[model samples]
Target: MDETTYKFLMGASAFVIAILGLMLAGTTILPEVGLEKLRKARSILIPSYFVLALLSLVCCLTGYDRRIEPASTLLVASFQALLFTMSMLVFIRPNEVRWKTVFRQAGVITVAGLVLFVSFFRFTDYYSCFFYSGVVAYVLQLIIYTRKFMLAYRKTVQEVEDYYDDDEENRLVWVKCGFFSALAVGIMALSILFFPVLYKYFVPLYVVFYSFMVMWFVNYYRRMKFAIPVIAAMPQEADVCAIPETVLAKTDGVAAEEAVAVAEEAVAVKEEKSGAEHLLKERLQKYIDEKEYCRKDVPSGIVADSFGMSKAFFRQYMKDSYGMDFRPWRKELRLREASRLFAGHPEYTIEEVSEMVGYNNSSNFNRDFKRMMGMTPKCFCKQFQ
Candidate 1:
């Protein structure tokens, strides 16, 4: 094919990709529209995409006439305009701040983009001013959007934390996704500032960035795992689900008081039965107290077996009473014992102290010590001297 034909094909393909993106975004939002309004918006956007595609193809074929090209430019420009308008509309509607704020920020960008287009219209004569203004506007929009997104994300994170403490793993995953989404949006906006001079190259870069964002939302919705249970009688009211009795009991003062009383009574009755149990607990505590457990890389399962209890039951009991799993509890015990040893036996090097604490690696010991004490073990020991 000739050079002109190749350029035409390339421009047409880019326009098609843009249209596909627009179609995806459009369909995703259609469920929110009133039935009567839906048909009208779809009609306008669908035809606009085809018309602009054809116009872009024609401009490429006819040697890139500015007037002819501007039609295609306007088509591209209209995407931002629609985005801005939608953002403003959502902002004005009640209970739509998330959508509204997003769109409003987008709208500001779209309006500023008109200035960038005007710069391109006079690119040869005022190239520097055009580039600077475009870059400035893009940067400003990125900052505004990033701030708004982070604020909304923090609000959502707190809500998630308050509502679902049990599913902490999923909540953390969503928080990470939300952070990356904001970062992606910022990167895409920054990429656009370069598009005026290097339009052909960065076009695909923008497309891929946006595609990843859409995929992120899809993944987030999928990973929320637990279902919101349905309630028939209170159709309008929010659904409720059963919380673990143990979790609820901790917070209910009367239940907690009753539990404590029952625990004391049980302990008194079980004193004779608990001679073996007390001996086992004491052995574990002594190992920790003497720093022997820290010196050896002893598994909690092995400890439980030595004490004549199943590892599972031992883990459950420790978790219920102490609110820590075996590994962390043991680590804390070892670290505490290690801290004392390190302070008293100043002749031992940091590496020797680490080995004594059951940490195979000095770096790991240092990290754990700093995490628990807010300082390195050596620094912590120096305070005494």
Candidate 2:
């Protein structure tokens, strides 16, 4: 087969692989046990993957020529533009399902796409510039979008861990899967940009990476062993035996011995209860001290596993003991840490401080800080200064 055909085939393979991976990752029937949060995430990612796949096809069909037919150029450029815009909107306004941002982004993408599409035929000399510039712009936007998504993922994980009682295991599955998916996409982008010649060769690598993602989802769903609720189980109080006055009066010596045995058993039960409580407290403190809970995206399953408790039980414990849900608790912890970091670490920038306290966006950091501390990071810093 000719080089163009080979490239097209490779692109098609990548597209197929990406689609299959997304289906596996998102579909409930794929034997991948994911929580509701993960399911929602998959819903977003599946379409994103398809857009990326279409872009790859466009690139492959257009070939490496600077002077391509106007029709072909339009197809390639239009797809790239659409892909870039959709990615940005998806990254930014993920929660808004009305397609408002999607439509807006699509408009921008179409304008840019049309310019390149028409320019290919109208001005062959500038084809390289148009193509390369559009690619670079798309890549840049993708990088920003990916970073934002990663941050959002972390926050979601943290919220899941703090608020939900059951499905701790499932939460971790989703977080880890999402993290690796983003990482894989980033790596693919870097390879395509920096090593264009090797792009065709990397088809197998993409296949492998996505295959693992699918497998992970399938395995996680099948196990589904981590569905313990947080508040469902309370420690039972030990029964205290009451002795009748007649028995005690008639038995004399035997009665005294029986009473002593009962006292010993009661003492043992109390000690056991105290020890259990102490162990739980120590575990909880360790979780806090490690700073894992501070991550915006940490899932409750991870924390529950760390404490050797079921997710439901952990949720109940946090509610009963802390009197707040997981998200609020994490927010409170992050803000407190951000405050301390701001006061003590004068050398760090506000951005750095925000990241250290588990914030992905500086704007979010500032907003959360002001809401919690009643001032911006700069103002808070002035107090320490």
Best by TM-score: 2
List, residue by residue over 125-205, the lDDT tens digit for candidate 2.
Answer: 886788777767666656665565566555544433444421233334554454445455545645554445654555666
TM-score of each: 0.39, 0.41
**Top-scoring candidate (lDDT):** 2
In order, candidate lDDTs are: 0.51, 0.56
Error of 2 at 256 (Å): 62
Q: What digit string (tens of lDDT, one per residue) describes model 1 on residues 226-279? A: 211110011244422111113223444567668887666666645633564566
Clashing residue pairs in all predictions, respectively, total 2, 22
Ten contiguous residues minimizing lDDT sum, candidate 1 = 226-235
TM-score of 1: 0.39
RMSD of each: 13.8, 16.7
Overall local distance difference test of candidate 2: 0.56
Tell me which residue pairs clash in candidate 1: 87-103, 91-100
